[model samples]
Target: MKVFVYGTLMQNHRANFLLSRQKYIGPGEIYGFSLYKVSNWYPGVVPREGDRVKGEIYELIHEAEKTLTRLDDYEGEGSLYQRILTKAVDQKGEEHEVFVYVYNGTVDEEKYIPYEQQPWRG
Candidate 1:
């Protein structure tokens, strides 16, 4: 299965160890979502018209895929974030339907980060 990673899980980020074994599918962007700095440790995203979030796509092996549950727990799936199916455009302009983690809390306008400055670096 494929997943879109925008923040901690993106390449070169501190939390990338989570998907170090997964196959990177290259850079991709999901539209209709705005990225925000949820905290000093990570970022959150919410759906917003005319917005986009840039990130990377990875293919998880069957065994590695099971780690998603762990990732969920780590992400506080029921509260901090939610995994959802969404469409993303790859570097080649190909559209792909993939799983992505989205923010589950109220957004703060001051925390909003522009698309070009995404994949949230603390």
Candidate 2:
């Protein structure tokens, strides 16, 4: 399955270290979502019209979905972040639906910095 990842999981981040050790198929870009930084700790990308979130597209290999599920669980999925299907567009302007996680629960949107203003370099 193809999955879109922004935030710490971008191609050149600490999170990629974990991803590199996984059974992933490939990496690409997915657009059409708006990236945001929540509470200056993590990232969130939401599907929005006329918005584009630049991130890496990964194809999970074999049963990588199960591994991903565990990763999500470790990240507090369904609580801190909820996995959902959303449309993402690539750099070439191509669109595809992929599974992604968005910050949920009681996130303070007002405190969220725009993706460009993300404070965490990690």
Candidate 3:
């Protein structure tokens, strides 16, 4: 299984331990969505026309199901964030269907982070 990750799960950020054993598929981008700083430590992505969120893709080669379950817990699936299958385009412009965790609750107006500036900076 392949998973798309932004925010902390990206290359050098924290929470990467969850993917330490996974195969790095390279940088990728998901279109028609915008990323916002939901908090000081993480960002949330929501659907928006004409927008794109940059991230990386990984292939879970071993214990794929267990890895996904752990990711669900880390993401607070069904509450804080919801994991969904979506298309992510790689640096080479090739698209692959991957799972991404999206914000599930209401977003505070004051916390809105524009796409021009990367919101993953902690």
User: TM-score of predicted model 1?
Assistant: 0.93
TM, every model: 0.93, 0.70, 0.92
Model 1, runs deviating above 4 Å: 62-64
Query: How many clashes show up per model?
Result: 0, 1, 0
Q: Rate the local accuracy (lDDT) of all candidates.
A: 0.86, 0.62, 0.88
Please give the ranking of all candidate structures by lDDT, highest first, separated by commas.
Answer: 3, 1, 2
lDDT of 3 by residue, 1-122 (tens): 89999888887888989999999999888988888878778899988899888889999998999999999999999999999999999989999999999998777767766666753666
- lDDT score for candidate 1 against the true structure: 0.86
Give the TM-score (vs. native) of candidate 2.
0.70
> What ordering of candidates by TM-score runs from best to worst?
1, 3, 2
Residue pairs whose backbone atoms clash in candidate 1: none
Where does the lowest 10-residue lDDT sum fall in candidate 3? 113-122
Evaluated against the true structure, the overall lDDT of model 2 is: 0.62
Error of 2 at 34 (Å): 2.7
